[model samples]
Target: MGEFSKTVGEQGENLVSKFLDTIGWVGAQSGESIDCCKSEAHKNPGTNGRKTHGIDFFYSTKSQLQDYTLDNVVMSVKYTDKPYPSNPSTLFKAHLKDLAYTIECYMKSDFRTDNNDEHSMSGIKQANDTGVLFWFTNDKDSDQDVVGKVSTIQLEKSLSFSSIYLVDNSRAAFIYNVIKYVRDNFSEYSFYYHYTFSSANYKGADNERYGIVFPVEYLVSNILPFRLINKDTKKNVFCLASREQFSEESINRLLYLASDISQDFTDEFIFLFPEYDPLHDNKVLMKAKRLVNAKNRAPNIKVLAYNNDFRGLVNE
Candidate 1:
C-alpha cells in the first residue's frame, strides 16, 4: 500500500478502536497473524501455499446479558476517501467473502484457542464467533447507508459463515453522536446501560446492570436506553437516544416506555432525537407532557436534539 493509503487505513482503525473503547470492548488484539487452517489453504489452487490470515482486530468477552456465553468478535475495517460506489454490491460481496474466510480460519487457529483460555470466564457454555465490517468514507457526504445499498444482494448458498454485522457511515455516526452528547453534557454522572427484555432475567446470570458495553440488540434498536446517576445527590437520570427525527407520537410512546422501564429512583428523563426545534415542536412537546402527567406517568421527561451527521464528530 502507498503511504497515503496506509494513512487512511490507520485513521479508520483508530476511529474504530476509540468507538470500541466507548462501548467497553477494550483490550482488543490487533495486527494479528493467525495460521490458516489446512481446509482453507487446500481450497485455493495457487502454487504457493498461503499460510496465514491477517486480523485487524479481535476481542473476546463474556456477554453481560447472555447467560454463560462468550462472544468472540473479529473486526475488519475499510476506509476510503470517495463516496460509496454507485454499484456497491460487488465491493460488499468481496469484503464479506474476505471476512468470512478470516473467521473460518480464526475458528480453528491456535490463536483463538490461546486467547479463549485467557479471556473466557467460568460457567461459559458456548462461544460464538462474530464478524463485524466497518466500511466508511471521509468524503464530503459521509453519511451514506452502505448496508441498505447491499441489503438486496442475495448470498450464495455455498457461502457459509457465522453472523456478520456491517457498520456503515450512518450507523457509526448515530453511535458516536450519542457518546459525544453524553460525555459533553453529563460528564460527571456514572453511565449505565439499562437492561431490557433481551437481557437474561434468570437468577445467577451475568446480567450486570452497570457496564460500558451495549447489548447487541441496541446496535440496531430504534431507541438506545441508558442511565446516569449522581451518587452525591442521588439524582438519577434515565435517557433514550432515538435514531429518527423528532415526532410528537414517538415522544409520547418513548416517554411511556421510559416510564415503564425506569426505576422509582429515577429523578429525570431525557429524550434525544436527531433534531428538535422548540419553535415548531414546543406545543406538541407541551401537549405530550400534559398527557403523560395527567396519566401520572413520567412527567420529568425532556426532549433535545443531537448531531446525526457522521462528520460532526471529526474533531471529537
Candidate 2:
C-alpha cells in the first residue's frame, strides 16, 4: 500500500476500534500477527508458504444475549478515500476470503487458546469464532451500501469461517447515528443494553443488569434496545433504535417489543428511526400508538429522527 493508503487504513482501524468500545467490545488486541496454521492451504500465489496473517483487531466476550456461550471476534477493516467501486463484488469476495482464512487459522492458533483460557467461565458450553469486515469509504458517495451490493456474491465452499459480517459505510453510519443521538439528546441518562429472554434466563446475581458489553449478534441486528437510567432521579427510560426508515408498521412493531419488555417502573418510552420527520410522521406515529393502546396501555411514546452524519467519523 502507498503511504496515503496506509494512513487511511490506520485511521479506519482506529475509528472502528473506538466505535466498538461504545458497544462494549473494549481493549481488543490490535495490529498483531498470528502464525498461520495452514501454510500450504493459505499460501500466497507466487510467494512461499504463508508464515503469518495480519489481524486488525481481535476481541473475546461472553455473550450477553446467548446463555453460556463465548464469542471470539476477528475483525478486518478496509477504508478508502474514494467511493466504492461501481461493482464491489470481486473485491468484497477477496476481502471475505482473506478474513475467512484468518479465522480458520486463528481458531487453531495459540493466540485463541491463550485467550480462551483467560476468558473462560464455568458455565460456558459453546464458543464461536466469527469474523467482521468493516469496509468503509470517505467520499461524496460514502452512503453507498456495499453490503447490500455484495449480498449475492457466492462464496467458495473452501472458506471455513462460519459467520462473517459485512459492515459497509451505510450500516456503520446508522449505528454511529443512533449512539450519537442518544448521547446528545439524553445527556442525563446512561445507556444500557436491554436483556432479552435468552440473556435473562441465565443471568446470575452478580451479572450486572447494566450491560456495558453487547453480544456479537447486535452488530448485525436491525433494531437495538436500550435501557437508560438517570443518575439523580433514578428513573428508567426504554429506548429502541430502528435502523429502517420510519413507518407506521415499524413503529407499531417497536411498540409491541417495548410493551413486552418494559417494567412497571419505566418512566417513559422513546423510539428512534433514521428518517423520522416530526411534521410528516406524527400522524403515522399517533395511529400506531393508538393501535398498540387498544391492546395494551401504552406509555408516553416520543419519536425522534437521528442524524446520519457518517462523515464526522473521519474527523473523530
Candidate 3:
C-alpha cells in the first residue's frame, strides 16, 4: 500500500473502533471477530482444526436496556478506503459474491447456536443484521473529485443481497441510502447511469493529462452530495477518476464536464474504446511501418469499443 493508503487503513480501524463503542461494544479489533468461538475451541481441541471466524467487535448489551438476548446478535464489519474500482458493474458482482459467502459461512457456524442445540446440527434461521459499511476520511479538500455526485435507484425488483448492497455503495452511501433513493426517485423515466473512462496515458503534448473526464461531469452535475461512503465511518467526499479524457475530441465533452466539476482533481481519464475501425478497414489493423507518420497518423479521438478489456489493460 502507498502512504495515503496506509494512513487511510489506520484511520478506518480507529473509526470502526469508535462506531463499536457507540453501539455498546466493549472491545473491538481491526481483524476478524472470534470471541464467541474462542472458549469453545479451548474446550474441544478438535475444534481448533476447523476454520476460525470472527466478528469485527463483540459486546454485551446493558441488561436493563431491552429484553433482546445478547447471544443472538453478531456484528461483522468490513473496511474500505480506496475508491471503489472505476467499473461499477464488476465491483457490484464481486461485492454480491462476498455477501453470499459471508451469509453461507454464518449459517454453517456455531457462533449463533445454543449450547444445548449445538449437537443437533440445526442452523439458526433468525435474520442476521449487519451494520452499514462505514466510511472514514479526514481529507477535507473540496476540490476532491467526488464531492457531490449522487444517483437515485430503486429495487422494485428482487435482487441478491449483495447486489442490493452494491447499488447502495455505488451511490457513495450505505445500503439504506440506495434503498431510499430508489424508493423516492425511481420511476419509469429514470435510466440507470453507467460511466466509463480510460486509464491515464501520457499526453503527446506537455499538458501532463490522463482519465475519463467526460462522464465524471455527468456524475457531478446529476448526482447529489457527490461523495464516497466508507462502510466503517460513513459517507464522505473523496476524489475518484483518472485524467485521460482530454486526448480525444469525440469524448472531450465528458472531459470538459469533469474539468468544470473540480480544478484540483488530478488523475488520468480512461476512454471506453481505445481503438476501433469505423470503416471496417483491415489496413488499420495492419502493422504500421512506422509507429508515427504524417500520412497514416492515428486518429486523435479514442472511442469506447465493446471489446476493450479495461481490467486486462490495467493489469498489463
Q: Please name the candidate that would achieve the greatest TM-score relative to the true structure.
A: 2
Backbone N/Cα/C clashes per model:
0, 0, 52
Q: What is the lDDT of residue 116 in candidate 3?
A: 22
lDDT of 1 by residue, 1-316 (tens): 5999989999989988888888767788789988777555434465466677789988787776666777788989988988889888999998887788888888888987886786555777777788888888888676767778898898866655778888888888898788788877777788877766443635445566656777654665668888788757758888899988888788888887888777565748899888777768888989888887787564576777786354434323
Better of 1 and 2 by TM-score: 2
TM-scores for all candidates: the values are 0.87, 0.91, 0.31
**Which ranges of candidate 1 are over 4 A from the true structure?**
38-49, 119-121, 199-201, 263-267, 308-316
Q: How well does candidate 1 match the true structure in TM-score terms? A: 0.87
C-alpha lDDT of all candidate models, in order = 0.78, 0.81, 0.33
Residue 294 local lDDT, model 2 = 90
- Residue runs of model 3 more than 4 Å from their true location after superposition: 2-7, 28-30, 33-54, 58-93, 114-128, 141-316
* Cα lDDT tens digits for candidate 2, 1-316: 5888889988898889888887778798898789998899998899889999999998887766665667889999988888898899998998888899999988888988887887665566677888999888878566877788888888898889789999888887778788888878788898778766544446544344448777677778889888899978878999999988888789889988888778555838998887666657778988887887797575888887776455334312
1 or 3: which has the higher lDDT? 1
TM-score of 2: 0.91
